[model samples]
Target: MAIFHTSIKTFSRGKGQSAVAAAAYRGGLLLSDFVTGQQHDYRRRSGVVESFCLAPPDAPRWALDPRELWAVAEAAERRKDSTVAREFEVSLPHELSEEQRAHLAFVIADALVGRYGFAVQASIHAPGTPDGLNHHVHILATTRRIGSEGFGEKTRELDVGPSGKVQVQWIREMVAAATNAHLEAAGLTDTIDHRSLAEQARSAIERGDDLAAAALSREPTQHLGKHAAALAGKGVATDKASTNDQIAEENREHYDFLVRKAGLEGKPAPVPGHEPVKRGGRVFNAETAGLPGGLELRGVSGVRLQNLLLSSHGHTPEQAPISLAEKILDALRDVEEISRARADLAMEKIRDALRWAQRQLSSQGETSELRQWVTNAALQVRALKSLIISRARRLLNVKSATRLRHMAEQEWERFNADCPPGSTRYSRSEWTLRRGRRLSVLEKHTAELKAAQERASEGELNAIDADILAKAELLAGLPHPSVSALRIAEPKPVPPDDLGSTRSVPRGPTFH
Candidate 1:
């Protein structure tokens, strides 16, 4: 395997306003000594140092004098138990670009927030060398750390104590995450893991070769497997650390039990909670699962509901590779676009079908004239519900262009479906029997999806907007005659005999 290299610099703020200075100093030191895949040290070339520090920039007004900052940084490094602080430069593989380097920094910073509940200040340094290969260095740090009382500046510098151990672990995680994210984004799966350098070193030591172990520890192992193989050539044996073994030792429970408990094995979704009430001959209930507290958190509208669901439950499920929220949001965005497109497609189909019907009738020598066929009123109501859902998805996804299209399609469908039959004048068209029943059902679904999408945005989490949109749209189209009639007149009742009892008898004059 070829080597893949990354440079991660860890810094600590001493006392006072020297935080940025300390950060820059550590950055320069790391840049100087980074392993650039070459045999000779790149820092030895005086030109490298001169060119690095002199790169174009109007230095910050708040920046401390370079001389004073360097003195402060050097003093901190000298305070460490490990006395030597040298900056070694390494040329990274040509595949990495400056943008990629910056992205890498962001990924590390973001992951740190997720794992450690802290955010970091980051910077990327572009490699300046003749190989035409790009090498970028990253600095992972915090502007300040939060304490119970208030925020405080970082006072401790980097060293090999408990804090050092913590920093090392942090570095390992950052490197691993950044590397994986960068490679994945770049569409490269077969790369190296730089985080396991320490583990590999420990393994090599256990194999009875002190020299090989020392070499592996000191030399940057860009590719863990390759590094191990090279060590093996010198009769140094090493084994990949077994995370499963570590977990088993930590927990006495059977592995299977642990897996299930951790939700490694598939777990069924819990049934959502709702209080059902019979209204207009249909079951109705207020959705409680995604709402703030089942009390309906105020100001959260339907437009944002899908995003809310994504925030609460999307990432927790193991079935999704990304966060469930992310998947849902992606799904929602896709579904909204799909639903809108679907409505348009549905229109096209309707137009084609209607046109064919008109032509066929004309060919049959009938003169009734199709006269602008419209969607059934019931279907129109369903379309409105679909439009609302699609619009909600669009808003949640931050895509607003499709909302109008969705609305128009819905209105068109409704106008075609619900207009009264045999109305000769346009004025009477407004009074046609509407499918109040089906519209009501669709309205409910549209409202729910909109609410979910809104919650997702508030939580700043991933949302399955598309999936919810599609499902809600489908529900809106369901036929419901009883509710449909609500808009036009009183709901029709069952015959008294069909009700299993005769409540009243009809009185009429006898023909005899």
Candidate 2:
């Protein structure tokens, strides 16, 4: 299981620096600070001090401006020793839909408020152009505790003291758990605990590694020595040097030292290659006699076989009956597994092909051929369902067998009319089973196609072309089109009751 790490840090901010005030100013909302004894009457706009001009008139009256909140949090980080509020941003792997992102923000907000008793500042922002993703949310939370610790007495608020190092850890753990639970419930299993690395810093905090000392002791940077700006600017020049001069000098000095230590300066120079050396076959000399496939091996493994052929049958593995039988059996089992896997893959491919065809026929308004194709596809799907039921029953898995049987029966019921049906002016025969069996099937197919067309019109997919059914899936998915206007008849106004009796009936060309 993947784990999410947590951390916390705190700092004694500079004199007169108020995180709450900054947040309020950035959000363009009036805020009351109990510490400073200030309150704003929003109804009369009487205490509109330092309002954010950029804020829209109808914006929510939340005091914590998301931008200011983020800024304050980021600034709170301790760069060297002092406190600086800062924020950590994480990029999710999957692009969530707008609805999903909204849900995430709400869940996080609720969790924070439930635990801390203070509402967190939450906001969603759109990425700049070039990013097609539709989801990005930022959560800013107050560091101070609004009420008593609920989780435990040793809660982050009470344990961390003033610096907040302790709080970061608990915050990370709780947030990660909440996020993981939410995503898991929604079937979004592919996610990352981005805070895990930063949480390691909490241990440093416990060890009394103050912010200043921690800042001085820089992490061992990996990948490259230069910073991003330097790297992007240009390459650096290097001094030229001989490749082996230093190594040769060291070797000569070592040789002299060894000669002196041995007390034999005139000793005959050690033969350069006289030392006995172990070759490839030394390890296997006589230790493996009766072991399987180990006695006087001849060419057997692929590499050995190739080497023997290269050397004209010089090396081979000695094989016994048991070893050969084991190898053969292993190969057979692998082949069988591969065959089964291939069959499953083929079935999946066929299913995908049929679905694609259905979509294509659905896009092309209504046509006799399209209707027939749809009917055939539906029957094929039903047949596959029947096969599934039969297999389940044979396997003796009653639960699965019953489930498949139920599904098969339901599908059969849907195939009401014999095999065909009739057509009508207002609604096609497809809408009713009273039509002939043949017409009924045709009508069903026609109805499905019409539905598909409607979906396409609502910006679901491109007009499904015949080519889509036959061609390899285009890797580039389709984009939804802009919403189009639908024509609606406007109702005319009726004459007022008070004016009804005042109108005189005029006769054409008759003098009154």
Candidate 3:
């Protein structure tokens, strides 16, 4: 299958990353950083089919050389926390030939330079694993624009603001479109989507396939970094990746079970223990509660029932009817469970973003202004965490309410079922009245659940947006080197330390 995978990351000194090293590794070359005096040699690396640099039409001819371009980039940056380069890693379809993949990569690279004025050094890598799958390309782009005069100012559109997101979206869509065009020309049947998992699930539901929607609705996993991915590839389990895999597998199993059960009965499968019963006069007790055949009545009280039916299900005692309280309570419990899962996922993402920002701050020499910014960001993260915790507490309440409601509903159903048809204990007219009341309560509860979900989603989006903006501001505040004085210098060796031996010291201080 052709999968859509694209990741954009920056190589910044703030994160202790070197642009020259990044270029060498991706381009499969032996390049030395003159500024840091560190050599990056990856020439022995296999599976790099092709590597080349792309520049704007107005760019100087000298900028076409990857080693020269990256060396200049390293020398141009004076700040300890400067953003050196931007990398776009994209997965190529294994179905495509080596030539086709290379062509696709070049097309994307050309688009990047043309649109963003960035000098792109692209490398098409063949699969390296034993199975020889996962062909991909690495695109290293200069932060500054290149022209006839020299490397101009940094490109802002690809760095921050709403424009940055738009650029990424444009690149992703272009990749998918270009790949599909090639596949279509080759008469291949497979295709890929740039939409997220949630978006895809919603589309599936709109197309009337509830099963497919459910199967696609699992929470998307976090990206595994290079080390974690490598370990996982070697049959080692990682905590986050393993948990996500298990969740995805469970969703698939549940989908399969639902499909098979539906097929056998030629109808929608009912939830276990949710089917209507005919028995009557059964009292609520511990024994009845434990049985799967009917609802349990042990450890239940009227106060608990009222809490579940009236409060948790969004109904008042006067508005709620006793007869259908069980159904409403069950529905409310389901909503709460789903909401809790979503809240937990949102919290995880916020925490991850905070950790990443903190790491960047810790790597660089801090200033007072930077410290203030970090403090503000930390407070925002703490506030978001508190909100999530508050929501979780509410969910705990819902769980308690649901337990009580289940017992009451079960006992009531049994009592009515055991009564004779004409018995006063099971009045048909009263049952009909209660059913109508239950419907009204259910509608109210449904509306509340929908509102709660929307609120949660909004909070998650807001948290992510704020995180991005804060991080961008932090990066923008970092100092940059004066582009006018940048000079391409040769790599120099470091001076050796004297060990009480008669070794001659270098005349001038060597650039370490």
Candidate 4:
């Protein structure tokens, strides 16, 4: 499958990130940052297929070298807050040959240079794996325009703003188009989409394929950073990586069940909550079995679903009670609705935060501390919204759930053992005064924000009204048509040279 993956990040000195270090790691080279007096050597790193740098036509020839280019970039900027470079990491399609992949990367790099005039150092990497997957590229782009003289001013248009968002969208679209063209040329059928999973899900729903929409709408797993990913690839499991593995396993099981259900396409619909017959074999409920078609059990309690499937093909006495496919389809529809609702809630929170932020920016002046606070608050709200959405998508692992249940059971046993005879332990109230205080604090903050916005609105209206009055007074003082004709008839047009001289035109009536 050709999966789409692209991420953009900045290499900034403020965040303690060095362009030289980033360049060395991606290009598999040895480089030393002169400004920071630190050395970065990744020559021993494996799986780097190809690496090269691209620059503008007028850029010096030496600028094509990664070490020289980044070192120059670092030395040019005196500010500690300077952004040295922007990096774009994209996963290349494994379906294409190494040559084709390299070509695709160059095309993207050329587009980046053409659009932003930033120098790009692109590297294609193919990690060695059992499946020989994980082909990807890293494109480190200078944050400034490269000229014949050297690096010019920073490309402020590519900073965080509307223009930057448009630039990102253009890059994503261009990559998708280029990848599709190459796939077509190679006579391959697979394609990749640059859109988010939620967007793809919405499109599937509009196309009337709810099943596909559900499949496409799974919550995305968290991205493991380079070090974590490398460790996990080497069979070392971090906490998040382990959670992702469990989720992947669960999804695979669900997908296989769906596939098995799909095989029984023409079968009759299964009765909901059907009980198993116990004459020769035990029958499992369609819903309880969590399978698309119901399974019949043969003289066994607590047998695994896989074992039941292997044993029942020849030995089962009665026809399978219900179609598992229909049940699975129903469950998918339900899950799809829940996922859509959650997505809608997340979007609503984001929209509200954006609206509030816009209002704060527009109403408050540049020097207002309140305005800055509002801006920070808006950012925090947006971050919280994202956290909420991500948390909502997280599925509870079966093993974790079972462990928690066992822990609770043990706690109950201990509590009963410790209880005195004929005495009872009353349940504690879940709500507390601390919770109330937090709620009150939140309410106070909301009230303060509302009052501030009201004051800003009044000030803006007053300023607008005063400006309107002044403009009206100025217009009232302007000469009438009759007076203007008299003035025009009295004066001759000034010559070109005299216009630059200290010559003055006849003055019109002035407003007080």
Best by lDDT: 3
Off-target runs (Cα >4 Å) in candidate 2 are: 1-94, 128-137, 147-167, 194-512
How would you encode candidate 1's per-residue C-alpha lDDT over 1-512 as one tens digit per residue?
Answer: 21345443443333222333433443433222121121222222211111112100122211123333233233334333322121212223335433344444444444443333322333344322212233444333332333332224442433447885665554454354345335544655434444354665575578654433443443221233436544543434455324333443443333334335436435421111111111233321112121111111111122222233333333331222333223223323333333443553233332333344434444653222222121242233244445554444445333211232233345446645645455553355343433343344346435544554564464433334454355444444533323333334555564767668966756798997
By summed lDDT, the worst window of 10 consecutive residues in model 2 runs over 478-487
Per-model CA lDDT versus the true structure? 0.36, 0.35, 0.60, 0.59
lDDT of 2 by residue, 255-314 (tens): 455446435645333211111122345333111111111111111111221222223323
Question: Candidate 3's residue-wise lDDT over 311-387, tens digit each?
Answer: 32244434434322232233233223333434323333333333444454457543444444444444443333344
Q: What is the lDDT of residue 384 in candidate 4?
A: 34
The alpha-carbon deviation from the true structure for residue 251 of candidate 3, after best TM-score superposition, in angstroms, is 3.1
lDDT score, residue 212, model 2? 21
Model 2 collision count = 45
Off by over 4 Å in 4: 36-38, 128-130, 256-512
* Residue runs of model 3 more than 4 Å from their true location after superposition: 128-131, 207-209, 258-512
Alpha carbon lDDT of residue 84, candidate 2?
Answer: 29
